[model samples]
Target: MSLRTFKMVIAIVIGGFLIAGIYISVLVVERQGALRQISLYNPAWEAGQAASEFIRLEQRLSELGRPGSTVDRNEVELRYDILVGRAQILTEGRFQGLLERNPEHGATLRELQDRLAAIQPLVGELDRNPAAARQALDILRPLEGKLAQLASAAHNHGAALVQKDQQELVRLHWLFSGIAVSLILIGVVLILLLDRHNRLLTRAHQELHVLAHQDALTGLPNRVVLRERLEQGLAGLRAKGPSLAVAYLDLDHFKDVNDSFGHETGDELLKAVAERLRDCIPVDEGHTKNLISRFGGDEFAILQTGIRRPEESAALAARIVEALRAPFSVNGQEIFIGTSIGIALAQGGVTSSQILKHADMALYHAKADGRGTFRFFEPAMDEQLHARRLLEADLRKAMANGEFELHYQPQINLKANEITGFETLLRWHHPERGPIPPSEFIPVAEDTGLLSTLGEWILEQACREAAGWPRNIHVAVNLSPVQFRSRGLVQSVSRALAVSGLAPERLELEITESVLLQDNEATLSMLHQLRRLGVRIAMDDFGTGYSSLSYLRSFPFDKIKIDQSFVREMSQRADCAAIVQSVASLGANLGMPTVAEGIETEDQLRRIEAAGCTDAQGYYFGRPRPARDLVHTLAALRQPTEVA
Candidate 1:
């Protein structure tokens, strides 16, 4: 039963109990009042009976006082005394009992007691003289009148009590009837409300069940519901020998979408993608099914049964990718999202999980091959996925294990041939994988969100190591695009400077053009924040990306490093020399220091120095080395130079 139904039933039961209590209370009050009235009237009824008996005895005594009658005075006196004593006893017992129970009747009972006491004296007087019998008769006659009046009052009082008791009975019946009617009305109302509430509860429960099985954002079947559907598809494939295909779809660059736009727009884009995927798959003829579900954030899966061939599944996957390639307009921006689809065919006793894994592997390949594409699963993909997973796991533990180290490449003053600073390069020495190059692991770290921690570690280590170096040379560290986009990048830099006791003016953060391609405001804001910290900002790999001049004008960078590609071809190509010379002249005009990278020979260094480049770094000066090796090299360079 639903919670609402249970509550409704409890409410109805409580209402019934309340009505019953009210009815019982009313009955008890009426019954108690009737009992009190009966107690009051009983005394009056007993007094009336005693008074009538006294009148009858007095009349007998008057008849026996005639001259013709022989009278026994002692017997008459004894009988009269007996009558008076009986009357006294009855008056004191029953009337006093009534007065005790009903104090409101105390005055009437006392008056009756006084009258009975007067009758006792009169009876004693009659017993004393038979001649006084006539006088007594006369007194007894008026006494009889008074006794009759008392009897009449007693009868009236008894009648009044009976009338009161009848009224009380009527009131009790009315009260009980009203309570019964109220209880019936309440029961009916409760039953009606409970029935309505139960219906509403049932509807709500059904809706909740539907919602539970569905994705709240996209209205697609959720992971749990999709898993059940996939299992059923697998069962059918196993029993009927039909081919089933599962495709895992992942949105490429979805994080960029969420980062550039807000999450609300990202959610809208996901819902739009889900609708497109659902529309792409046609329903099967009869028993076979095509089911679409949202696996998780920007990840979706589809299960298609009764495929005659693997190529059909590939076609379906392609259609899903093509559908997602359409631009989604959300929040007044035309957002383009690409999807990579992975297809796995059901055969060779593939379980649900294995099929899903194969599809995911294909998706990974699709994404790696460039998004907006699809790939069919191959067995060897499992090896690549395993290796990737292992690499990710090791990367997570690399920082804590102290397996990472920095190498410094000295930047030189091209004209003076003096070392200006060193660029810090990160390297990981894995125990099992030997030395892992930055090219291989840096991208992985960026993709896996390990770059933030790795970047901070390198910064802190470089700052600390540079603090111990000679005061003339500055230390430069490369900031990955991931780290630059991090929320704590500025704070991390500030903390590194404070902790290492390294002056901010001596530290330079090298950032690529990709970091500036995001929100220009945020990027500029972060750049301005770092600039305010008194650290030199160098545009690394300059002229390699679009908007080289625009970037220079947007933010005031202290230095611009000419990419090695342009520097390497300066000896062979005149165009490379002209480009370097133009960039150097532009830097000089803008008051920004220009450094040419990858200067190998004295001739190339002279050419760059003649081009007005202030700084240069390459093998010509010194190769990247560890801190100890760089220290020895710095010490050697500080000695007197020997001209060859």
Candidate 2:
């Protein structure tokens, strides 16, 4: 039965038991009440008491009848009153009902009452006349035999009533005993049912536990099982001489397969991958000492034990990678996919969780170095990961702590020899570590999803600060590629302009070619939307990507900022100078001004200017400074000083 049905059955059984118990209790209460009513007045006892009282009264009257017998009148009166009281008791209440049931007993009691009533008048006169006692004695003497007979009949009736009650009590006792036995039998049946239910529950729990630990699609052990084996393997390594390794593998570009073909093909491919992974292990050591587990969604883990050398684990990883490189036929279609593996070898102090994390870190680096390869976890990777986490944590709190500041680097117009605008650069001054470079924290912000909030703040702050600047100069803020992929990029830019009351034309948004690399159409559409908002768009870090020129042709940017790397080496490298001249010429032909960045020295500045660059931004102009320091810095820059 289903669990709900089983529960309902148990509930019904318990309710039946409760009802039966209550019924039995009610039976017991009714039986006790009947017995109590029967016990309230014993017919035999009443009859016997009446007979005794009469005999005493008779004997007292006989004494008074004897000549010169000294009997206290009060004693005689008390005996008389007691006899009358007993007779009255027999004729009233429960006794009266019993007397009515037996007509002989009722008639005898009435006759005795009539005789006592007749002697009562003589007994009262006995105090005044001695002869009255004899008369009273004569009347009471005949009542003795009648009262004895009445008592004997009452005794017989009481015996019959008691025997009937005893028989009924015997029947009730048997009934109760049967009920008790039935209850015990019901309890046994309930216990057996409960035992059966418990067994079913236990079996179901075991099945559920297996399902919890096993991957449904691959039917292989999942991460939970992998972690368990890793713990066991690590324990064995600590106690024994051989070491173990955990390799975390992630399918590279698996999402493309799902998108291109379908998820069904992807699932079949994963199942096929699972089979190949099993084959990749040595036939003798399959799943006994080493375990392979799926970590869900294009990720899997392998635990290798009894390793004498690191090369052994490396060989296994290589075998798996090589095995997966061959295309698999899924749904009659040839599909090619590769895996990236990160291996972490067991050590004295390394735990299962830490080793797993280390492997994941290695996998990240492997993917970074280009996928379809494997890497070992190194100490430096752990250190760098730890530092990045610390920086991310600090970056989250930096906004609320008011530690973020906007620094604007003046973009110099080479033709006018005057300042054109400033590029809004974000700077973070950690309370303890001092200023953290944007290169260090920016990626952390992107990874932690703090970039949206940070990006919005940057846009607003840059616009607000630039709004206070001289109207002719504009402020340029570089947008992260992640910000473009995320929603609300357009809304954030619009809000920053609106909230700061800055003209959209004065706000220049810069993006690199990387933004267009992921979603080319979407990025261009976003650029168009930003352009419609009356803002100037620029391509920052120009000439960094192979498709930078094509991206410029796709969108009409107001300005192009030549990458600092090219400008820095333009003086030393002929190719760098030619590229700079070419980008400047290209920008001029497009009617877009090209700003040469990293112009530190006069010779580099002269080369870019000679190359027909429109604007230059670097140390040769001024270092990026806070908005508050810009006015004084600008005035100082306008005053020419002799070169040292």
Candidate 3:
């Protein structure tokens, strides 16, 4: 109940008590007055009866004394006795106290006594003579008139007192009734107020619940609420075989928006996007169930239910992408954002965590392909992701346990058939798996963010291994794009060179095209820092990416290694040979030496040399081998070589 209601109820109860108190007081006062009046009336009536009886006794005596009449003494005595009894009866009972208390009733009792004394004298005179009796009778008549007048006055006064008491009693009754009515009205008012208060409290509670579950910015369900809903949907799906779909949506380039504009603008853009998503989902009572939620930051999740097939989820994913493709207006600025959606559907044997993981894996694939796309979950994708996770765990242990080893494949100067350098490769020897290939684990290391440690270790190991080799032979180690983008890349390389006691001129770092495609300032700064430290930078796998001639001119590179794909295709495709030749000519013009990789035959080696490639590395020269074997190969290169 509300305060108003409580107050009103209290007021009504108090009013009732007040009215009851007044009525009780009135009843007590009125009853007391009536009792007093009745007491006075009884006394006055007794006095009048006594006086009338005395007058009657004297008259009877006078009648007996009349001429020639005989008086009966016994009859007169009996009549007097009866009159006394009547007077006693009038004075006795409940009203006797009023006669004793009232001065007027006391005086009236004395007057009655005086009148009876005078009547006694009259009775004696009547007994003596007839004339005397007649005179006594006449006097008795006047006394009787005076007594009647006094009795009538007393009776009238008693009647007036009784009337006054009756009036007070009636007024008391009305007052009590009025009080009761007022109390009833107050009670009614109190009930209404209490009811209103209760409703208000109920509404406030509901509003509080809504606010707790909803996002303050977008008025959509928040992450906590969304997770709860997802769990409930998943539980239902577990019981009955209904397909449940979850799409993890991330706004592409959201960081760019934050970098370009302020966070305020980014927030506005997110709210707008949330509204668009809410509007895009269809509401159907029968077929489809959809709920959009803000999953914090620029990420959102959509729970789609009742999907019959995987393609339906894919279609929903596409629709989400389309919905977010439109530009949003934030603070008068037009901001465009694309979305990458990862969708996972619940089949029979999937937990919520596994489903979310699959969705994240699909999200990874979507981002890998490009932004503004959506992908469905695949079981093999989950296996691959799990493998990467396992590799990351093992990589951490590998660094601690010294399980990483370096192998070098010699890159030969094809024209002289002389060893120029060895390309460093890292191999992981897992205690359980024995040997994990670089092709399978390198990408995993990069994705798992273990490349920073792994890359530096390889650099140090390779530089130390090459320090013992001939002075002309250099060591080349591959750098992942993730490692190249790291802020500590230059410092790490400088430290490795220092620790190994290897000439920085002989320590070559091989980077792929992906590294050059990163942020210009950071990548360029890193490259320049490496050059300043006397470390050679080579562009590896040149033909596979957006490798332009302009990059060669813009950035100083020591060499350009043709990708193995083009090198292997040279014998079958004339275009491959011509492209390789063109790249080598371009490298020569730019003063950057060219290295052809994957040279398997003399024909491929001849084509590379004819194309003016300076260095070659493939199975034809030597496959990647341990340092001991590579040292022997290097020592054999020191001997005079026979031309092919």
| lDDT at 576, model 2 | 97
lDDT of 2: 0.85
> Candidate 1 on 458-522: residue-level lDDT in tens?
99999999999877789999887788677799999999999999999999999988889988799
Worst 10 residues of 1 by lDDT: 635-644
Q: What order do you get sorting by lDDT, best first?
A: 2, 1, 3
Residue 202 in model 3: lDDT: 89
- When 1 and 2 are scored with TM-score, the better candidate is 2
Off by over 4 Å in 2: 1-340, 343-385, 632-635, 638-644
lDDT of 1: 0.79
lDDT of each: 0.79, 0.85, 0.76
Q: Quote the lDDT for 494 in model 3.
A: 88
Q: By TM-score, how accurate is candidate 3?
A: 0.48
The clash count of every prediction, one per candidate, is 0, 0, 0
Candidate 2 vs. true structure, TM-score = 0.46
What's the true lDDT of residue 94 in model 3?
46
Better of 1 and 2 by lDDT: 2
Off by over 4 Å in 1: 1-323, 327-376, 632-635, 638-644
Clashing pairs for model 3 are: none
